[model samples]
Target: MANYKPDLSCQNKFISVNFSEQIQLGTFEYALYYIVENKLDLSGSYAWYDKTGAVTYPPSGMLKIILLGYAHGLISSRRIARLTKQVFTL
Candidate 1:
């Protein structure tokens, strides 16, 4: 067996968020997230045999954020991607 040790410097290098303050009831984002999780079935659309490695978020999550961005008049791909991270992280 190989020995392992924790890195002390990286222990404090993390960002924290307050989920209760970020997601509120009756909000569009919350509603969309709720529908995506509880109401919609997206597993059928995901690939099963793909070997693309790990993704930051699932494909369905990216699609939902992109669609939401488009609905809000965001046409640029970069902008959409940035907004997707921001909105999802919150």
Candidate 2:
């Protein structure tokens, strides 16, 4: 076997930033991408920021969570919310 690795082995090499991928899931992923890019407010924009004080992922956190919900078929935001809690509770 060759003692080498593929070009995509780098951490940032896998994502395509073209914004033109025609896949069905592209819209969902792109939505989250732009939300973070522009630093736009998210669903919990009205919430008070706890200790860290930066709106606590106030940009694409919800979008990212919702996208993960869609990817894993978590139809309810309540369920997705639970996932977020569980993840951090680890």
Best by TM-score: 1
TM-score of each: 0.58, 0.40
Compared with the true structure, what per-residue lDDT tens digits does model 2 show for residues 29-83? 6655655547665435434434443224432445566776878899998898898
- Clashes by residue pair, model 2: none
Off by over 4 Å in 1: 1-13, 19-21, 48-56, 85-90
Question: lDDT score, residue 33, model 2?
Answer: 60
List per-candidate RMSD values in Å.
8.2, 12.2
lDDT against true structure, model 2: 0.53
| Candidate 1 to truth, TM | 0.58
